[model samples]
Structure formats: C-alpha cells, structure tokens
Target: MYRKILITTDGSAVSQHTACAGVKFAQQMGAEVLALFVAPDYQYPVYVEIIPPSYPSEEEYVAQMRRLGEEYMGKIMRSCAGANLQHACMTAFSDTAALKIVDVAEQEGCDLIFMGSHGRSGWGQLLLGSVTNKVLSHTTKPVLVHRLISEPASG
Candidate 1:
C-alpha cells in the first residue's frame, strides 16, 4: 500500500531496529526509503581568549554534530544490504527533528513513516515526550510505531 517510506533515525538501538523492519516493509511493498538524521542544535558561548568560556560556540559544536551525523548515516547506508531498496540520508543541524521528518516525507512524497517508540511511561514520558509521539500528533501521513523493548510478562 505504501509507495514511499520515511524513516527517521537518531542512531539509537530502537531506531536501528525499526530501520531493519522498515527495510523489510519497503522491500515487500516495492517502495523507496528516505532515511534522515537530525543534528540537534547544541549551542555554546563565545570566547575571545585562549582560555575559552564554559560553553563552546554553537557553530563549531553544530558542525561537529553534523560530521558525526554524516558518519552515522554512512554506516547506515553501508549496513543496508540485499534489500535492494533505494534510500537516501539527510542531516539538518538546526531544525526540529520531528518537523524535519515531516518535511522530508512531504518533499519525497512519502505515504508511510516507520519509527520506533521508546515507550516511556509515567513521569518520564510526561517530562521527555518522544519524537514518535510528536510525529504521530502532527503528521497527516500513516505512521507505524514499533516498540523496541518487549514488555515484562504479567502474573
């Protein structure tokens, strides 16, 4: 049913697990995949002398993050073998990752999004809302959220 799929990765285990699943889904549906990695804006304070301030410049930190992101994306691309799915990776340093996912999907004409949920609960979930939650709440496209960690058995 899906012609194009968008998969967002933060280089987490759950994200990688979901990526594997997405590759399978894309293969089954004969769809292309667009994988994205967002470099969060890690800002630092500016300094004049050799003894720098507590925080580094936002520009330098962001560049470092972007380089790391690119390396991670390279690994992701190299890992996808035998699926024969057409895929591309993108890195956006300053943008909100959730929104970037949506924007890429729209730009690529994606019909489906495959992502992983950490399944945070109670206070944790409340305090640190997940990207999956945001994407689900905001997007008009169909999303499949995979729970990476299996739940404990009940009595």
Candidate 2:
C-alpha cells in the first residue's frame, strides 16, 4: 500500500540489481519512486591529507563527486524510463549514509525504503558497518533490503 517508495543506489552491481526490484515493485504498485545516492562530502575530508600528487581543490572535489552522482543516478533513471515508472532522483553529501537516507525518506514522505544490502557478517560487519542495519535501527518507516549475492546458487 505504498504510495511513494524511496530507493537508494550506488551504481554498483549490487545496487543496480536492487534497483531492478525496486522499479518492478513500483511499477506494479503504481507508486512513485525517489532514487537517492548519498555521496561523500568532498568539501570536507576526514582523513589526514598528505597532498599526494596534486590533491584536488575543494571545488574540483565537489565537481567530481557531482559527476559521479550524475552517472550513478543515470542508471536508475534509465531503469525507471524503461519501465515507464514515475520517478525522481536526488543526491546528498554525507559520510553517514543511514542519516541521509532516513532524512530523505522522511522529507519526501515516502511510505517505504528499498536499498541493496551486501549482507556483511561478523568481523567485516563490525569493521565496515552495515548501512542497511543503521537505517533499520534509525528509521521509523519500513525498509525493504535486497541482499545481493556474489554468485548464483548451485542448485
């Protein structure tokens, strides 16, 4: 019964796979999709800079991030276009994906959130942190996570 669905993508194979499901679901439900790509804040670098081989200027970094965002958004846009689904795209700067994702879903009044999940476990999960888990913990809305498999199952 979702009228609006928020889908997050990174242009990765996993996210691309996840996007297909989101688009198909939206098409079936007649729901509007909002595709979001949370990108790194190029204006601010958390890591120490050694200035290795001419580091890009703040403006340059911002522009680069924007270009990447555009390319990533393009994938979802094309999928939506092919499916003839009503959709829009958005990009935001954040090191914390969960915060930005949840914020956008709330702001856009989306009834559901769909994101591609890597399904990390144990040590890797602890070290890298799962964005899906973070969003699940923080958001009040329902989230549908599509776990991307590295390989097809051997029947």
lDDT of 2 at 3: 93
Off by over 4 Å in 1: 42-59, 79-81, 119-129, 149-155
TM-score of each: 0.75, 0.81
Q: In candidate 2, which residue pairs clash?
A: none
Q: Which stretches of candidate 2 lie over 4 Å from their true place?
A: 43-53, 119-129, 149-155
Model 1 Cα lDDT, one tens digit per residue, 53-111 = 64557766877777777765664565455677777777776446677777777877999
Report, for every candidate in turn, its global Cα lDDT versus the true structure. 0.69, 0.79
The best candidate in terms of lDDT: 2
Root-mean-square deviation (CA) per prediction? 4.9, 4.0
What's the residue-level lDDT of 68 in candidate 2? 83
Q: What's model 2's lDDT at 47?
A: 58
Clashes of 2: 0
